[model samples]
Target: MATESTMTEARPEGKKLRANVKPAPYRIPQAPPMGWSPTGSKRREWVSRGMVGTIMFLQAVLTLRLRNSPSVGEVHTLTDYRSTPFIQGNESIYPTIVDALGITGARFFSLLCMLACTAMVYSWSRRLFNERVGLAAAFAFAVIAPTLVVGALATVDAFGLALLALATWLTIESRQGPAWPVFLAAPVAALAVVVNYSALYYLPVVTLLALLVSVRVVAPVMAAARTAPLVLVTIGMAAFTASVTSNQKMPESEDIGTLAEGTFHWLGLITGLALAGAGFYVKRARMGEVPRGYDEEPPGIGWRIMLGVILCLPPILAPVFLTLTPSVAPLWKPPLAYSALFTATMAGVGLVRIVGRHFRFPQWGIMAAVALLSIGMAQSSYEYTLWPNASRLAEVLATQVQPTGKYLASDPETINYYLKDKTKPTQWTPTSAGDPTKALKKMTFDLVVLERPFLSKADEALEAELRDSGTYRILNTVPFRLGWTRGTHEIWIANDVPVK
Candidate 1:
């Protein structure tokens, strides 16, 4: 024994012999324990929930105040229940509801959809980050002027946004348990894509969520199996795009394009391929079978996802501004509210984290900042596209136009809504197409109304045509205010020298 001890331990204190320690056994990553945990203190949770609820309530009350407002006056009408490909599904929804309950019901439905979207935003952020962040996101969404204005209109944007938020929430929930939630997300995503081509941009996000949830809940092989539904989503979107493009009625509708136009351009396709490759890499890397406590450590994959999404807000929100461009734009005009809410929520979260960790600033500072952002954004969005005096404009046009006369107007829908109540029986030509001197050379309109300064190329051309044509005389120039934008609409009568 003494000899053995001397051989094992008699090594000098300064110079130790190498110890034999085998490397840790290779273990596969195990699934996270399935459950839900409420984030943040109980008091804070109640406070956040209360604040979000109050904001939604206030927004609803404000919507009631603007009940007469023709928010979607120019877009949605009985004649053309649907305008853009994005709201194709909404064609059935809007016309049916509006035909039954009138415009008020349509606005109410939109408001309800927006409220649901706001609630989903709160729930998603609350589950992923914390109750405070969720409240901030909800508040931001609720206060955005576009959110309220668009929601109060009879448009599909609010409904599509609601569906997207629901799909996102379900995708996150898929990680907590059954794969059915993930499967359910596929159809929801497909519906959103059909409703608005711009919504196709969300396909990558849904695919990523499915892959993450699958890898965490099932084996790597199972992850691929779960992700198969993503292919179906892609196919569904492609079909919808093709079908919409095929149904163009106009000789040269600006919206005429192939399946991979605008939001689904080559850039989007490449980005989607990269996401698929990343998912495959994630699957291969996690093939080892480990225990279920993979999320016990700090900054787990879930936290990384949340952080990544927060960081991506800039790029994600930037594309929304593209709606201002006419040449190449998304079918459904982007409701800037989504980006505004995302930015405000991210800002709120960052400010709170910084203030709490470094400056010891009051928590109220975060709420204040969020409120200010919400109020300002909402104000900016109010009446941004709405013609407040559209009813008056319709009445004036009706008075000037004879029951049997053909009157050309910029927007038929706006005039149609007012005409619904008016006893006028005038026929209106909604096209703004005409050459400066040649368009009306063969055609004769009893009256023409041109809204200026013209934003549409065709409308500008028609306006110049009417002004330059010697056969027409300007009767009256009616001026109107569309929120911040101001314009004058000219009423022109054909100069008819009596044939007698």
Candidate 2:
């Protein structure tokens, strides 16, 4: 009877264990099921990404179209300084890249650089701050009128600016760790200097600062390694520039004076400063020690004062130098001053962030300030669009002058490009400040074109003498009209001149 009871108890326990067991070929442990809901922040981020992509695509398209337009005119004879090498058919070293690249190639390359720079800036800014700050900086660069105009043409300014933006991005990125990438970027920076000699001045100042930052972040050994490529590339570029400029004659010192005179654009400088100041304030208030919602950092008073002082330096120095030494002063004109202000402001804000504990700012204020500054800059560019009017004058000359007659142009560069291969004139007439009448009298020319603005009182007297000499008669007095401004261009013909 005891054995029977034991069996009954054991059977009940076995049945209970069997009930808990499952029959399967293989058993797999499952991870905790993930929640399916999407957060608001994630959705907003996706939307912002889509918007940025769309905007960039549109900007690229607009820039491409602007570059392709023939109506914009050839950029070859934009300045007299660019005329000599251009007309001489010097292929190895062009005075200005606009002559070398041609319209299409220049435009394409410029657009490419602009887009790349914009993207790099956006990426760097975003990494440092929030998406809003990144967008603001990128948009500010993209919409800047001078940047757009320069980018549309075949000049080196746009390319230089692009390289500058790239260098800044690389330098900032390198601050995070080892700066191997800066070595790769050095060649590009060097190329920028080759393209524009002014970049030599600008790059060194920024590069030194960058190196200091890099050394502080990374070890000294690593910084040196990163800087080695820059040193090599810079040396190579300097050699190349020297070789190209060695054989070329220096432009007349007076011509340099004229260039300096034309470069003064005060409105542009002011706008640049204001924009920079606003950017600095916004960046500091948002990203500095004080959290945006909380008033912890108190607006970085020390940083603001320092930046304000720094921003004023360029403007002050520019005038003093211009007054004391006009030649050197104009060389570092409004553009450089404006660039300095922007750079200093950004640097100040960055310094504030390094010292601050938290980062946040009033988003609306930043956007408003950027938008206002961009609009003002765009308007300023519009106002000064046709300052020299060389291209427009060239177009007029092309239409007015006949193909068979010998024509003498005061601005030989413009005529050479517009009348290339046409049997118009013996190209040796001096239309600059020098006396060209002896040369003019020696050559029997059918027509003579003179840009009145370039003529001094003495030059005008000579022109009048030519007109009154009875050997040549006035054919057309082409008024050099520029958007409500009436300028003058005089055309004359010899009574019995031979066709070329």
Candidate 3:
């Protein structure tokens, strides 16, 4: 009986010992993290880090360049210089956000937003259908030329596009589950508006999308209550920042015009909203109605229609909007317009890839379109930069004049940059034109440079009056182009004028 009791106890102990013993090295190793393995409080870190690095590097390469070298020319230079004062004043955030981050900080942030957009697109594709569809959606975004080119510029276009893309991604992702990130998207979007006023146009669209996504996932009442405060806060913050920065009052009259003008003013917003709605509706309606007996499941007619609408909306609406509103019209002008077109093209390509199984058509078509558009734009830009009339005028002012001369020139910025330490020069402005001329009479300038191209027909009479005063003598007619036409730039010497 004693031996039996002892053996039973020892057997239990031995079993415990075997359980404690480590398995051989050949035993299956702990599975590395899979797509959706970890539960709450766990998330992938490396992927996010890698994505951030990629976004920053791509933006830097596209925008960074040596100072003093010509880059895209006047507009870019002016923007850079103008922003310098604001950046310096707000050194804490602006420096790191703008200069230190490189020339294309806005573009970098935009690209990051695009990557998030691609992620949402992939999710939408996968949830609606298969891995093949998801891959196709991603591929479509990769080759979009408009997006790539705009992404390449160091401008506000990328910033606005990025914010818009982020808003879209957050809305779409929220449909999957409780998306706290969607709420956070409001502040980021508000910041985007502060960066570029054009982004203000997207506010309504983003709010609608967020509400739509939240209603689909959570209850409508709850979602509305949750999102309402966020929307209000976003608008308030945006308005406050804009007012402080520009020292301008906000335009409160939503009577910004009738449907015709509103439609034209916010065309991109309308198109984006339509496409997003179409996409969501199609995805919801055609959840499992794939045709059988085929090797692959083709998207339903509704899906195809939605994709088509998304692809066509931008180009169709762009002209209508541009034509209707002349006040904030530059949004549709070249270079700037190119950015929107590029973003629309990218989104369209992504849609086509999702709807059509064949990718080559949209892929190659988008490439060709972008290439042709870029070439034409570049040629036009080059022509404007090398405007012969302006160049000739600058040459005369820089070379023909004697040193120690006091001169007045219209649009003196370009001349000042080129003719450092050559002459005492003052810029002619509407307010200063009279004062400057009087001063020139008093001290007697060696030469006064005035380009006919820079002045209107009325200003030509002013030029003749200055010559007729007998205080100044017309020294030479310097051919130049400061505006559009090739015209004479008068060089006047103050030899005949009495010195004050």
By lDDT, the best candidate is: 1
Can you tell me which runs of candidate 3 are displaced by over 4 Å?
A: 1-161, 238-407, 413-452, 455-458, 466-500
Off by over 4 Å in 2: 1-101, 212-216, 231-405, 424-428, 439-443, 497-500
Question: Global CA lDDT of candidate 2, please?
Answer: 0.51
How high is the CA lDDT of each candidate model?
0.57, 0.51, 0.46
Q: Considering TM-score, which of the candidate structures 1 and 2 is the better prediction for this target?
A: 1
Angstrom error at residue 20, model 2: 20
Candidate 2 accuracy as TM-score = 0.64
lDDT per residue as tens, model 2, 1-500: 56976666555354364444567788887763434322237776786677566646655654544322222123332343443431222233333455566656767676676666666656665554445545555555455444454455554555666776676677657756766657657876776665555455445444554565466566778677777776676677667766766666543233445434433343233335344544566555554333244433333555444434443344334433333221211122323322532343343233333333333434534454455355535443443334334555566556645666556666554456555655433442545536667655764655677666644565676687686677777666656443245567776767674323
* Number of backbone collisions per candidate: 7, 4, 5
| lDDT (C-alpha) at residue 357 in model 2 | 35
Q: In terms of TM-score, how similar is model 3 to the real structure?
A: 0.53
lDDT of 3 at 146: 35
Error of 2 at 299 (Å): 16
* lDDT of each residue in 180-290, candidate 1, tens digit only: 877888888888765545456556656775776567668878877777787678677867766765665422223324322433331232223223323332333221222
In model 1, state the lDDT of residue 80.
49
TM-score of candidate 1 on Cα atoms, chains taken together: 0.68
Where does model 1 exceed 4 Å of error?
Answer: 1-46, 61-77, 81-91, 213-219, 246-297, 301-333, 337-348, 357-359, 363-375, 378-388, 420-426, 436-443, 455-474, 483-485, 494-500
